[model samples]
Structure formats: C-alpha cells, structure tokens
Target: MSTPTDAAPAQPGVRKAGEDLLTVTDLHVYYGNIAAVKGVSLSVKQGEIVTLIGSNGAGKSTTLRTISGLLRPRTGTVVFDGKSLVGIPGHKVVGHGICQSPEGRRIFPKMTVEENLELGAFLRNDKAGIAADKERVLDLFPRLKERIAQKAGTMSGGEQQMLAVGRALMGSPKLLLLDEPSMGLAPVLVDLIFDTIRTIRDQGTTVLVVEQNALAALRIGDYAYVLESGHLKQEGVARELLKDDSIVKAYLGG
Candidate 1:
C-alpha cells in the first residue's frame, strides 16, 4: 500500500504546490473494525480543483466524509485553512467554511428548490448575504431558477444534482467537497455537471472532489490522487496522469 508521501517520489513535482487550503496527513479512517482509508495523505491548494479518483469501495467517499466531519479518523489529521478539523462535529464543519455535496444528491425531497437552498445557509444570520447567494446559486443553475417553486424530488436527476451543488454553494464554502457529482447521470448531463464544476472553480471557491468518472474529473482537475483499496496509489498533475499508460489502462478504460 503506497502512500502519498512515497507516491510523490515516483511522480516528480507532485508535492504540495502554492498555498495549501486543505491538508490531510496520514489519515486513517475505520468503519467499525475494518479500515476504510489506510494512511492516506493529500492536499488541496487554494483556488485549485483537486480530485480523488478510484473505483468502488476504494475509500473515496470515506475520505470526503472524514474531511466534512461526518466520520472520525482514528489516526492522522485534517487541517483546513491552518485550523485542525479533527474531532469537530459534522454540523459545525459547515461553519468552518467547508461544505459537502454528498455522494447521492441528497436534496430535501418535500421542500421546494428555494427552500432547500435556504437550508444551506442555516448557520448564517446575514440576511442580505444569504439572499444574494441565493440569487447567485440560481444564476449558476438557471434550471433551478425556473423550478424554484417545484418540489426537489419532482425534478430530474441532473436538475437535482445541480440543486445539490447549488445548496452547497449557498453555504459560502471556502473549500467545497463534492462526492461523485457525475454518478448515474447521462453522458450529456455528465458533461454539463463537469462544466458546472469548472464554472464553480472559476468563481473563486477551491474544490476537493471525489469522483468515479476518471476521464472527466482529470480533464478539469488541477491535481489528482488515485485511491485503490484504501491506499493512495498515485498523485500528480491531472493532465500528466491522463497521459500515464498505467493510469489510462486501469482507470481510463484504455
């Protein structure tokens, strides 16, 4: 099981670049007695879109959940913006400027689109800012604006995915954690979703996404890490990895 520290040596210039906004050092997460993430380490620089790509049961979602405070790491640390996030409760994680659009598009089924978005800002009291953000989210997902009064469950999968991301943005996150944004979407919707991710990054929020769509994710990512069976197998510039024969063979279906 190679770790990021050792893996970096195999890929020169893969070390942390610029200013790191989020750093996970030797992270080890467990589900009951089984180790889900085994001594993984990675970093996301400010304003960059970093991705974690792997197959099923590779601990990709587990890493995001740990970073978002949904799961506790038995060892190692999660540092965001120079502050340690270890042991922080899940709900309070949002207040610290990290927000997650989880694996499944977990939008409020019974709530209208607008109401679901408002829930993202639950920790904030700045009414004006919240209102402004709502407009911004609507603008990002114009389809959402059209369905503002419609129930979230009634929307299509792509629309609900957009809503999930929009709701996370409404929280005004400094670092956005997106888990499997492209899962289960049609090819056209996948393109739209990945495009939207770039748009979000261009808008100035840093992103750390866990994705199963290796090709699409690597195409837009600044940097990427490969997780396999709870281990960090590779780490490098996304474009560089895209050209690697082994990576292409294993993850890109070449």
Candidate 2:
C-alpha cells in the first residue's frame, strides 16, 4: 500500500480545473465474514458531480465508508490529490479536505442545528472563514437558518436531510462525499436535494454522491459509475448513461 502524506494544500471549497481530486483503485472491503465491496474502482475530477448509484446492499455505502477512512479496505488504495489515504483515520481524512455526510443524515441528534454545523468545522481555527461558511449553509437551506437553535433530532426528515448537507458544506470541503443524501423523502423534497447538489458542484466543490435514486443521480451527475452486488458494472458520462438501454432497464425503471 502507498503511504499517505499531508502534502496537498487545502483549497477550502474550491476546485482546480483538470485535476483528479480523488481516486480509488481495486477496492475490496469486508465486514469480517461478509465481502461488502469487491474490486471497485472510480475517480472524481475537480469540480464534477460523480455519483455512485446502486440499489440496497450493492456496496455503495461501503465504498464511501472506505474512502472516508471509516472502514479499512481489505485491498485497495484511496488517493486524494497526491497523497495516499490507505490507513488514515476518519478524522485525519477530514483534515485532508474530504468531508463525508454519511448515510442516515447522522446529525448530532442532541445538539442544536447550529452546534452540529459548527462541529463540522472543528478541525479549523479560522473563525472568519468558519463564520462565512455557516452563513453560506444557511443561505442554501433557509429552513436550517430558521431552525438554527432547534435540536437536530427534532427536525422533520426532509429538514434533517438538508441540515446534513449543510453541515458538510460548513467544512468548506474541497472534495465532498455525500452518502444517500435523499434516501427517504417526498418527491418534491427529493427534487430540491438533487437541485442543491448540482448547485454545490457549480460553486466549485467536487462531489462524490452515493445514491439509490439512479435516475436523479444520473441527471445531476457529470460522470457516473453503477455498482451491483459489490462490483462495478458500468461507468460513463452521466447523460450518456441515462440514454443507455441496459442502465435504464436495470436501475432506472425505464
């Protein structure tokens, strides 16, 4: 395995053109007796929305977990910019400018919305920048601004989902990893979340979103990889994949 170093400078929510911000090669993850992910490989270029879409139990979450360093891969490499993150811990991975808004919205349930958002920036000491990011998050999800003082656990599911994404943004991540951003929500709210994802990419934060909503994910993505039973089945430009007959039949309900 390649050794990781803190050689890459943090860009703080900005991305440079033509640069590969993240790369994973032949990743295999296991949960003791289970092989959750097998031989998965993918990449996210700077300023692109690269979605990993699959059904339940397809290893989408496992792939994201490995990249975030929450789970170690049995065999693989997670390279961020020029550094290797093979054995880096989750907290250290955040310091490398990759922040993951995990599945289940994982907000600090007992803490107020404001507090949870602040915790996302705990790795930083720049008060002014953190303040700016907090305001930006509120702008993106006005509901969060309205409920800033309310406990996160009390918010509606849709509201909690918004808060989750907003909290990740508070980190000013250069490469944002969003796992299941719209898992359970009404159609209107799902549309809202997908739109916000595109807007996030437009604002220069490269994104790797893992979603079960194949059609929506493909529509907003710049590129995409389809995972099935812990293996990669296909990958291509997002728009092209949308038109693919096989992809439509298998995942898009076309």
Candidate 3:
C-alpha cells in the first residue's frame, strides 16, 4: 500500500479548468439484494464545503461509505484528485488522501485519546509532520488536549465527536468525508461541530459531508444535495436550497 510519503500530487493531469476536486459518476452500492445508493453522481470543488442532506433511508451515508472505500460500488467511478478510486482498499483510500469521520463516532473504545490519533497517522512516516498535525488538531479542539490520556469511550459525547474529527485530521486528508457529524449531539455541541467543519474547509481541505441536520449543514456549506429514497431530489447552491420552498418545507420543517 502506498504511504502518505507517496502522496500523489494534490491534483494532476485531470481537467484543470473546473473547480472539481472530486467527482462521482453513476455511483451505485448494493447490500445483497438491495441497492442503497442508486446511480448517484456529484462533484466537489477544491476547498469547498459540500453537503449531502436527506432524511433517513435516503442513501446519504451509503454514498459516503462507497466513496471512502468501506463498501465497493456495484457500478460507477469515484475520481479524487484526478485518480480513479474504483478499486482501492479502505486503508489505501486514506493513502490516496481521502479520510472519513464515520457515522456514530466510531472511535477506539479501549484506546487513549492519543493512541487513537496515532492510529490515524499509521500511514505516514514523517513523525515530525504527524506530531505537528496532532498539535494543530488539539489547538482546534482544546478540550481534546486536556483529555489526551483519557479513554476515548469514557469521554462526553461532544468530546468523542471532537476526537473523531481530530483523528481524521491527523492524516492531513486532501478530501475529507464526514458522515452525520451531528447525529446525536446537543444543539450547542452541534454548533461547535459545524463551526469546526467550516474551519477545516477554511484551512483548504475539500469536504463532502452527509448530515441529517439539513438546515445547519446547508447554512455553512457552499453547495448542497437533497436525497430521498436512494435518489437525488434536489441540488443547488446552499443558500438557494435554503430558500427553495419545496426544500424548506420538506426537509427544513417548513
């Protein structure tokens, strides 16, 4: 497997004209007899915060899983930084500069906060770079710096969520895939998490986020897609979607 040192150019050979840093075409993912993501296609520009917002069972998470290589697509292509990510393994996907903070805060329950972060940098040989990124992540979440020696599973829900995002940052992903980062958080924590996401993009990482908190997600996002029952229902600039009556009434609680 390629390590982070083998870091491919951030973008190369692909179309240099458009803003697209990652593109998915006719993507499809199936679990046995059921297809969770059905022929979905989308593009995320470099350094832009794009969101996929939808109700449960709408295939938002499945689309994200497929892109991060946790599940293979039955059909379609995932192009990231100009490389086809069709057959890469999940770990290799990270090496390709894509990392995900998966749904449900899937942190290492038995590991210390620092240990979990070290795991995220397992592919990088540059110890100094890893340490620097760790420090930067901690700066972004000072609450985590205080809990460095604590067990990940014992932290508060907000702390655990911060740890998840921090772990993904330890690798310095060029494209970050976040799955429902606000799933069960208190409103205040939700705001903090969303603010952190904006900071991540501001620092130049392209983001493709899936969130059920439609309003909050779109409010901070540059673009948004609305999905329903494994199909795309609507898509547009985030502010425009926020003003669309159908979108506001259907997904934003009217």
Candidate 4:
C-alpha cells in the first residue's frame, strides 16, 4: 500500500491533474469487535467537493475517522497525496493538511470563540499566517466575529457549526473533511452552511463532505458515493446519483 509519504508531486499528464487528493481502497475498520466500515473505497480529487451520503449509522462517520486517523482501520489503504495514511496519528494528519470538522460540532464549550479558533493553529508556527487565516475565517462568517468573546457553548447551534468550520480552516488544511455540517439547523442556516462549504472549495481546498441532507449534498457535490452497512453501494457523478430513482425515493425524499 503506497502512503502519502511516498507520494510524488503532481506530474504532468502522468494520470491527470487533481485526481485523488485522498484515496481509500478496501478500507476496513472496527469498533472493538464490531466492524463499522467494511472494504470501503473512495476518492477525493483536488479542489473538488465529494460527498458521502447515507442514513445515520451507515459508517459515514467511521470512514471519516479512519481517514483522519481517529480510528485505525483493521485493513485497507489510505493514500493521500501519494503516501499511505494508515498509521499516521490523528494530530499528525492535520499537519499533513487534512483536518476534520467532526460531527456534533464539538467545539470547546468553555472556551471563547476566538480562543477555540486559536487552538486550531496551535501546531502551526507561522504567526503572521495564523493571523491572516483568522481574519479570513472571521470574514467568511461574520457571526463568529460578533461572538468572538462569547463562550462557544452559549452560541446558537448554527453559530457553533460555523465556528467548527472556521476552526478547521484555521489549520490551513489542503483537504477538509466535514461531517454533517447541516445537521440540526433551521432551513436558512442549512442553506448558509452549504454556501460556506462552496466558498471553502472555491478558495482552493479539496473537500470530502459527509452529509445526511442527501438532496442538498448531491446538488452541491462534484462527485458522490452512497454507502450502506459500511459497504460501497453506489458511486457516480453527484447529478447522476440525484436523478437515480431509488436514490431519489429513498434518500432525497422525492
């Protein structure tokens, strides 16, 4: 299994530019004895928005966890850039430019908004760059600037979700993994969250998004995968999946 450490720089026409920023092949993960992800394979290309859509408990979060190094897969390969990510530590994964805005918006409740954002840059040494990224995140989500001094726990659900994304951006990741960014928000806030995702992609970061809002996710994504019981059920361009009758009826609420 080739790892990101062995990955070569983008070569001209070797395959194609911007293919597979992250690639997981035959990945299998377990929780103690229970296998949560089984032989799952997927890819996220550079600067593309790829969404993994499925019902709850369908191994969506587990897949992200494996990629982020939160859970080590029992078998399979995760290659980022060009090297394997299998044995990398979670924190080290961030340094390699993969950062995750986990599900449940797990912002530090005790910390002020700005403090939480600062922690996101703790591993980075470039003071000026950190300051600049902070400004950019604040600009992207003005509500965050307004609540900079407020405790993260005290903010509205939507605001906390925004802060989670901003904090991940603070790490200046090349690849961003988002888990259910639209969960538990009002319709308006959901729209805002999805819009922010689009803005993040436009800024040149590749994105692997896991979303329960299948309709919205498919609409925004460039490519998508459907998972069931930890296995790959389908894969296609997002538009193609959206138009699929079974997908439309089952997931899109059509």
Candidate 5:
C-alpha cells in the first residue's frame, strides 16, 4: 500500500493548487466485517474547498469520520498539518484545529441555540478568541443570532442545519468537515447553505465537504473527488469535472 510519503500521483495536470494541509493516504477503515473505506487517498490544501461527491453508501462519510478521529483507520495515515491524527481521540481532534458538522445536524435538541454553539468551544480556554469566534459565527448566520435563546429542536430543518455549521465555526476550525450540509432543506435553504459554505472558505477556513448534491458541491469546490464503493473513481478541478460527460451523466443528473 502507498504511504503518505509515496502515495500515487493525483490526476494529470490536476495537482493540488495550494499548500497541503491534510493528507489521507492508503486509508482503510472497517465496521466489524464490512470494509467501509478501501485504500482511499485524498488531500486538502490550506485555503481551498475540496469536496467528496458520491452516492449514498460510497464511504464518503466514513472517510470524514476517520479524519475527525471519530473512527480509527485499520491501516494507513491521516496527517493534518504534518502531524499524524491516526490515534487521536475525537474530542481532541477539535484542539488540533479540525471540526466536523456531521450529517443529521446532531445538535443538542433540548439546548438553546446559544448553548449548543458554546459547547463547540469546550476545548478552548482563550476567552477573547472564543468570544470573537462566536461573533463571527453569528455574523455568518444572523438567523442564529435572532434565535439564540430558542430551543434548537424547535427550529426548522434549514435553521438546524445553519446552527450545525455555526457550531462548528465556533470551534474556530482551520479545516471544517461538512457532511451533507444541504440535506433535507428546501431549495432556497440549499442555496443559502451553499452560499454560506463559500463564505466560510472566503473567510479563511479550509473545508472538506462530503455532499451528495454533486452540482452544488462542484460549484463551490476548488477541487473534487468522486468516490464509488470506497474507491476513488475520478478527481480533478471542480469545473473540469462539471464539464466531463461521464461525471455529469452519473452524478449531476444530466
């Protein structure tokens, strides 16, 4: 298997465009007897939005879980900012500057919106920095600011999704892992979520998104990977993939 130092080359003329921040090489993960991720290798640069676009059950979420330390890889390496994150506990992953807004939002339903956002900074002690980040998140999702005292579960699905993204931002992540941010939202909210993702990237947080919304994901991503049954099938500049006949037909519903 290829290691981080000697992984296979990326697609021709599709080299990573910025400084490498996260590198997953030859990653293999399993659930009991089921091999979920098979030798998946990908990279995220310091200031780019890279997306994994694939169908359900394609191991995209499993890859994100492993990178966030929620699940351990049975083999291979997860190197973030040059340090191996293979055995780091999930909670500690936040301290290393990576945070995930998992699929299904996963907010504390009974908690107020503000309370839920506060929990994201549990690992930090820098009061001023945390306060600044809260304000930043609120700015990014002003709807959240208006509903700060409302119970999270009382909100609509789109609102809950915004809160999830905001909560992840409260952690002040250098690399944000967003899984299906547009899931279960109305068309308008989907547009808003994608807009917010671009804003997040413009504001300096690199993002690695796992999205089934292929067209929308490709629109905002600087680069993209197409995964099929736990293996990489295609990868290239997002615009290039968007134009590819095969990619459009298979994932973009062309």
Candidate 6:
C-alpha cells in the first residue's frame, strides 16, 4: 500500500560508505502482479567493489535492471552521483555513466565482437575516448582481443562472458553493474572474471555486481548485501561477512 514517496530508510551498515556513487532506496519492482523486489535499499560508493549475493530469483537481476532503467521501480528512488535516475531510460542511464553487463550475456549474437563493443558506446560522441576504451577492454580481456572479429554467437560461454564485460567497459561507465558475471563458467574462468572485476574497480570505475558465488564475491567485494526473496536481509563489510561462516551458510549457501 506504500507509495513511491515513502522512501525506505538507509541500511545500517552503509554509514561508512564513502561518497555514494549510486543509491537505491525502497525499490519495489514487479512483474505483472508479482512483486519481484521488495523494499531493497543499497548504496555503491565511488571506486568500491560492492556485491549483491543471494540465491536465484532473489531480485538480484531485477535490482540491476531497475538501476539500468530496463525495469522501472514501482516505488523507490535511484540516485546516481546526486542526479535522480528514476525516470531515465536505459540508454540515457548509460549516458549518465552507468552500464550493465546483464545476465545471459545479451550480446548481439550475429554481430562480430568488435561491432558489439562499438554498440556499447553508441550513446557517446568522443571518438578518441571510445577508441581508447575499446583498447582498454581488449587489454582487460585478451581472449576478447584474440577473437575481436568473430561473431559473438560462435564464442564459447567463457569467451562470450568476457565479451559482455568488455563491451560494457566501452560505454565508459563510472558505475558498472554486473549481473552474474561468473555464471556458467569453468572454475578457472570464474577466478579470471573475478580478478578482472577487481582490476576494473582499481581502474577508477565503481562496480556493483550481482553474484551467486558468495565466497568469490565476498573475497573481492569491499561491501556486500545479502538479498533474500527480494528483501535485503543482511549487509556489512565484505571481509567481515566472508569470515562469518554462519552468515554465509545460512543466507548465501556458501
């Protein structure tokens, strides 16, 4: 019965968050009559690697979609760098420096990897900057560099995953939203993906990742939120949570 104007209160553990780059409060997203996300509030500070850890259908992807403006929240506020992002469209959200590498690796299947990366920066006009970002993406994922001219659909799952993250980087995002970056990858590939995520954060981009791999996600995250059936049931410093076996075992199934 609550309306969008009744914003949820900030989570307790977020007091130490430094200069929030993305803030979502009281976000309630629905698919038809079903409430998929219920009152989830979280923040991502500038330059931090924040992870959302939970089981499948726990509103992780839904939250990212709402933030990216692919799904509008019925009641909430999404603020990015002091600018309200509630009504912004998905494409404009990219222009505001937020890009998402969505779940299922939604790359242009028929397009070559290079072409897909170019589409990631379609909203921009900076030719030099776009070119530099493309190179940077290639450097981050050498596998992608090797197959730059290949059609995206022909790549292996891990290779396609690399292309997804690489293409998101081409958008020159300040905050990158990654939905299940390690999904369906080999153990080594998962490690590689997590390592690249850390590298991305270190390279001056804030990262908000939705990951089902609790242990790996906690290992790389500065802060983490545990989502359960659409509610944020737990949150704290990632290191502390990683050390708390009870928390991980009970909520995140690590």
Tens-digit lDDT track of model 3 for 1-254:
22212112233212123568899998888999899988889899887788999999999999998888889999999998899998898888999999899999899989999999999898999989998999989989999999999999999988999999989988889988899999899999999999999888878888889999999998888778888888888888776687789998988999
Cα lDDT tens digits, model 1, 29-113, are: 9999999999999999987899999999999999999999999999999999999999999999999999999999899999999
Taken over the whole model, the C-alpha lDDT of each candidate is 0.91, 0.89, 0.87, 0.89, 0.91, 0.89
TM-score of 2: 0.92
lDDT of 6 by residue, 145-254 (tens): 88989999999999999999998999999999999999999999999999999899889988999998888898788888999999998888776786678776775566
Task: Judge candidate 5 at residue 83 and give its lDDT.
Answer: 96
lDDT score, candidate 3, position 246:
96
Where does candidate 3 stray beyond 4 Å? Answer: 1-17
Give candidate 4 misplaced runs (Cα > 4 Å): 1-17
Model 6 residue 35 CA deviation (Å) reads: 0.6
Candidate 5 RMSD computed on C-alpha atoms after optimal superposition onto the true structure: 6.0
Better lDDT candidate (1, 2): 1
The pairs that clash in candidate 1 are: none
Query: What lDDT would candidate 4 get against the real structure?
Result: 0.89
Model 4 worst lDDT run, 10 consecutive residues: 1-10
The stretch of ten residues in a row with the least summed lDDT in candidate 3 is 1-10
Candidate 5 stretches with Cα past 4 Å from truth are: 1-16
lDDT of candidate 2 over 26-69, digit per residue (tens)? 99999997999999999899888999998999999999999999
